[model samples]
Target: MKVDNSAIHHSPVAVSGGTLLAALAVAIFSFTFPATHWALGGFGPWTTVTVRAALAAAIAGPCLLAARAPLPDRRQWPAIAVVASGVVLGYPLLTTLALQTTSTSHAAVVVGALPLATAAIASVVTHTRHPRLFWIAACSGTVVVIVFALSQSHGAPTGGDLLLFASLLICAAGYVAGGRLARTMPGWQVIGWALVAALPLTGPAAALALGVEPSRPGGLSVLGLVYLAAVSQFGGLMVWYRGMAAIGVARASQLQLAQPLLTLVWSALLLGERLGAATPLTAVAVLVCVAVTQRV
Candidate 1:
């Protein structure tokens, strides 16, 4: 179907607006890990991942039709598939499985390194060359996170910790892919089409899962699943991809530095988890080191 590209055409969004929307996206995303932790008690991890994507695609589908948004160009399909692989399936599935064993508080601390991961991946995906110092900074951030993980002294890297680390790698790739696509396409379309592309797989998976759900789930678990589908998987991402495009991936991503702290706060308040006194210090150190990766 043809589109009046103008229907979804976004002019150059102001940096201030982009930053605010990015912050909003981050605020919404801060709920993801804790909510997933809660939802897992009710749903299988794979069920949660696939169903969330399918439900989100169901919402994005009608909106695309209503907007008359054209499908992304042929060449863009590959990138979109890669994005779907990571954001739609990889990150959600891995993190959900990880949280099945890891505390929300621990997940928050481990994910504190996401900004650095994004920065490093953005550089490669966008084909920008960073100075040697940037690598040094990236390594510094990695070291800080590793040391913090060790200090937490789980006595060997738990399976959950490894899953979270893998999730970071997949998510970083998705972020860079989304950011690159956003430069030419509207941000919303990037996520919209990714959801669409994932539908054939996730849609059926979700349908099958519905047949297997336990008769009754907690009220909060039901709410958590809805939030994951509506906000985390779909709506907030429309804002996030746009902001990443508008502000440039490098600068716009700096906002994620606050995500860990906010997530820690949410985990405590929502899940009644206790934060280590060292949590703030670890988050700050990771952020500072990650901040260095953006430097040329």
Candidate 2:
């Protein structure tokens, strides 16, 4: 039997490319919290969430039509709805609400557990078992996040913390579902269709929100809202799902461990949110866990 050197050589290249794409997505998402904070400076939370989804749908719908993208299979609609609800509606709304009470840095640290949640959910959804070491590292990371959250709230979980936790779980489900769907369809199409599917709900909701919410919409806030719509909602997920499809979802999710740290930096630079001593410490600890899981 001949061992194929070509396959051996190709595998690492593929993984590297996938890892790069996932890392890029993480970088894009890191700005989201600060952006949301900026948007909230001018718009109410409801208005911010609904308007971003509506704007993203506007962009994605036209792109799909221009590309002559085929409709998803009837079976896939349910999964697409999950994507829409989780990332498009649930996560953004919940996180924006949470950011109302919490600083962007605090929210970023609390969300550091997102990768662990995503990996756990991906395991169940894909029915793939990782090694014990992987779970240990992931759990360790979650523990760090939980401890930080508790300490920040003086041993009680604030409403913001609870909301962030809920957003984490739902967003993980969305990530896994979108990743699986990406295996069958183009990653861009998966998110594009999900945005279009969400339009029915988000369109009306945006209209109502704008009417009720009284937005000031300053220059920075408008730019922030546009970023949420164009990049965070649409462009980031396109590469993220593609990376998840290329790599396994579990592995790709581990890459997100870097997100909170990146977000911490953005919080300081963009939002001017002061980070305490524990924030960087917790972030580094989580990154250590990320390294362990990736190696395992």
Candidate 3:
């Protein structure tokens, strides 16, 4: 309920603790892909994303109501709406679609490049200058990841892969812009509003899922979906916002460098996909690049 902003600001220890917690949250968020893939094996991609969004909104929605948070200001609404599109709608939709065609490990590798994409957007939109090493890292990391991803591709390009990459770009923009906007509102409040705003769009899609004869998923699939909706989306957002608040967006985005490795680990565990020794090594290279890029 009541956050003591002053207390958190005064204490480096608190900030460090918060950042650590958020890093773990991002790690948890990465596993959602394999979980999603498992779920989609039963439910279609569209249905899975829609239901997840709907459930996330359901969980966070009541908290906003209980706290008596008011509607965002007119200026805030536009930004909130854009973020809602990306987080609530775009990211999930693209990721879900991508998983249908690719393994979760492969998808995680692609998404790992998101920090670089976010940095690129920051340069364009925010005019933030980054170090050359950062670009080197980003470019190198991304190239390797893409190469690996391509190797894993069973055949020629499906429209699905392109769509997934497009979604990544859109979501990257959302991450950059949303981080800025979240500065103005409470982190939870911002996410809560975005979730509600995206409901209308997600609602009809979810309805269509039920209309189709639903394929029955095993317990693992259901568990993964529930974890994705509740923990990854809902719980992850809470910590993410706090971290973003404690340290500005630029610094906060750096945490994403670790996400790909975490996802890779989860992929190995859940999907029985192996990244071998190359995975962690590649992730370290990417992380270094991301760190360099974020420097002032």
Best by TM-score: 2
Candidates 1 and 3 compared: the better one by lDDT is: 1
User: Which residue pairs does candidate 2 place in steric collision?
Assistant: none
**Deviation (Å) of 158 in candidate 3:** 4.8
Misplaced by over 4 Å in model 3 are: 1-11, 154-160, 276-281
TM-score of each: 0.92, 0.93, 0.88
**By summed lDDT, which 10 consecutive residues of candidate 3 come out lowest?**
1-10
Error of 2 at 34 (Å): 0.7
How well does model 3 score by local distance difference test?
Answer: 0.74
Candidate 3 local lDDT, residue 197: 89
When superposed on Cα atoms, how far off is each prediction in RMSD?
A: 5.0, 3.5, 4.4
Give lDDT: candidate 2, residue 72: 94
Q: lDDT tens digits, residues 93-115, model 1?
A: 98998888888877887888888
By lDDT, highest first, what's the ranking?
2, 1, 3
Q: Clashes in model 3: which pairs?
A: none
